[model samples]
Target: MEAMMEQREGVALFTICRPEKRNAVNFVVMEALEGALSEAEADERVKIFAITGAGDEAFCSGGDLHEFGPLRGAEAKQMLTRMGEVLYRLLTFPKPTAALVNGAAMGGGCELATACDFRFVKEGSRIGFIQG
Candidate 1:
């Protein structure tokens, strides 16, 4: 599986479980995130959400370009639009969201973190607003 969900400390944690690719977000991963977000939001047990990566290397690398290879301009744009919609829903979720960046967060991953109400990163990790 590419993701996992857990609850603790009055918060629900959604982890990007792919550490080999630095926890990159593919379409499937995005869907999993959407589901996790929806499930937690609907469950009254969840008051806050903390998104993070599974390993020490990265919070997320970005979109999985390898998953959508060689798409033309229009195709890429449409796909990106879909991803945007997912993020928009997450951003507008009623409860507070946090990105517990244990490591690097880049591109769409960084946007995911920024969309949250709080961003708590480890001391040595880097955060970037890159897109690729």
Candidate 2:
């Protein structure tokens, strides 16, 4: 699964499951995030929404360039636009949202964290926006 969602203790946890790619966001991951938000929003038991990445090496390194690097023109725009919509929803989510930055979070990963109401970065973790 590109991403996974679990509900526990009134929190809806969303995990980006792509450690080999540093938890980069691809089309599938984006869809997973959107779906997770929809699911959690409708669940009254879910009091908070939390997002994190798989493994300990990185929280998220941003876009999966290997998957999306080939795009141009309309294709690129559509992908970016979708991501923008997802992030905007996250930012405006009615319930409290948190970003569990378990490791390095770069580029779009950094943006993702910032979209939340709170960010809990792990000790010794790094956060940067180095992407162009």
Candidate 3:
């Protein structure tokens, strides 16, 4: 699994578990995030949703380029649409949402952070949108 979810004190924490890949978002990660959000939404006790990365090196660097670079035409569009829908869900989640940016947040990572209602960046962390 590329994502992990835990609940505590009415808060749901969703962590992207791919620090080795700079916590990049792949299809699996995207699906996991959607599932986690769905679970949290259905849980009445979950008053807030928080997202982060697993390691100190990066909160989320962006989409996994190596895995997605070969996609073209309809395939690429579909993937983008999928991710956009997931982010849209996060953006419109009923409860408050936060992005705990522990480190670098680039590209899609930045988009994810922006979708949240709140964003907390750690010291020395970097965030930007860089796509080619």
Candidate 1 local Cα displacement, residue 16, angstroms: 0.2
Instruction: Give the C-alpha lDDT of model 3.
Output: 0.95
**For every model shown, what is its TM-score relative to the native structure?**
0.92, 0.97, 0.97
- How many clashes would you count in candidate 3? 0
In candidate 1, what are the lDDT values of residues 20-132, reduced to their tens digit?
A: 99999988899999999889989898999889998999999889889866667999888789889988988898999999998989888888889899999899998987645
Q: Looking at candidate 1, what is the lDDT of residue 45?
A: 87
Give the Cα RMSD of candidate 2.
Answer: 1.0
Q: What's the number of clashes in each of the models?
A: 0, 0, 0
lDDT of 2 by residue, 14-92 (tens): 9999999999999999999999999999999999999999999899999999878999999999988988999999999
Tell me model 1's lDDT, rounded to 2 decimals. Answer: 0.89
How does candidate 2 fare on TM-score? 0.97
- Candidate 1 vs candidate 2: which has greater lDDT? 2
